[model samples]
Target: MLFASRPTCIKRLLVIEDDPLTAFDNEHTLKHSGYDVVATVDSGEAAVAVIASEQIDALVLDLGLAGHMSGREVARIARDRGIAVLLVTGQCPVDAEEMAVACLGKPHSAAALVSALKAVETMTCKNKTPRKVSGLTTFWRPEAA
Candidate 1:
């Protein structure tokens, strides 16, 4: 139940970012691009809480956060719960093993962010869950040939 009118068309997204400004910018970009932002959390703990409470469709995660668990951990939790994740990280750690649909390097533009979100939406539309998104869901893994 993401969009009030067309839930099947546009899905809800959760943003896990510690920086208020970055989160706001991401929210603004996604909202303007016709996506429903369900929630924005500044920590992994809050992210876990919201994921349990809300019917979320996708997640936009930043690598580093203020809590004990980083965004990689958040992505892992989301993947285990069958939620789509779009990772935005300054550094793509080699050890990350969870799944993520989209990964944008830091200092990305609003347009790039929008495009990444659209990719997530398309994957969700096709597969209903990110885990089934044809190799795009595997975190830190190169695209499958």
Candidate 2:
């Protein structure tokens, strides 16, 4: 008798956005896209706290967080911890392409977010190396809706 292989576990995502509405929308979209959104927080401090305590697979960070620590800093920390990070920002920083696995512009679609996450996961799984903040980056721009 042949036994079927077990399915891979869903990825756990953390959404860090200052805007309540945007955070809610992002959480909803990620959930419907099959990702397990472990936490949604409004500040960089909160994000750091959650990251330290959870088994998070990825982070959806807003560049302009309302706190002392910018999202860029948080992403760097997360990457150091071997977690993947994707930036969702209105004004993409000059170094964003170098800091994250992928950078998506603000007002992006759910499909775009999902696609970026898949690409990050694929690259991470293939490399089997510790996540480096200075690694190659993938910038995805969703078509106008």
Candidate 3:
């Protein structure tokens, strides 16, 4: 079945999780949900580097990363660059409201992940202006003077 208001652009997603199994699961879920899994990295440093260089549309980030920078730090940088982020952690962070679009607790279902992705897509689309109709003209008529 086709969606009535599907996003016009394909979303490129980056997964940043330290655990190998979790990373694999996240990648699998996103791929099946129709997002392009750009790269899955285990360290915050690597994730940050990829975010800087790649054309990523969103990020699925783990709170405790393998490297020096925590997921919160990485998310902050990604957000500054206008990339949408969803934080996944064993326990949700208190400051997630300021940094991420949403936070999912660890051991979440595939359905939950898909739902969060859709929310981010909708948020991104809202920032863009609707397409202008072609060959349309508006003439302003003066009231009788």
User: What TM-score do all the candidates reach, one by one?
Assistant: 0.77, 0.79, 0.79
Model 1, 1-113: lDDT tens per residue?
23232334447889889989999999987776677898988999999999999998889899889889878788988988988788887765665444576677787887667
Candidate 3 least-lDDT 10 residues: 132-141
Clashing pairs in 2: none
Off by over 4 Å in 1: 1-10, 95-97, 127-145
True lDDT of residue 6, candidate 3: 41
**Per-model CA lDDT versus the true structure:** 0.73, 0.75, 0.74
| Candidate 2 lDDT score at position 19 | 94
lDDT per residue for candidate 3 within 1-145, as digits (tens), equals 2222343343898999999998998898777767889999988899989988899988988888897888889999998998878787888777887788667777777766666666555445554322222221111122343
Residue 68 lDDT in candidate 3: 88
- Model 3: pairs clashing at backbone N, Cα or C within 3 Å: none
Q: Tens-digit lDDT track for model 2 on 1-145?
A: 1212211332899999999999998899788777789999988999999999999988989988877988888999998997878888886679885567777777776666666666666556554332333322474333344
lDDT score at residue 16, model 3, on the 0-100 scale: 94
Estimate the TM-score for candidate 2. Answer: 0.79
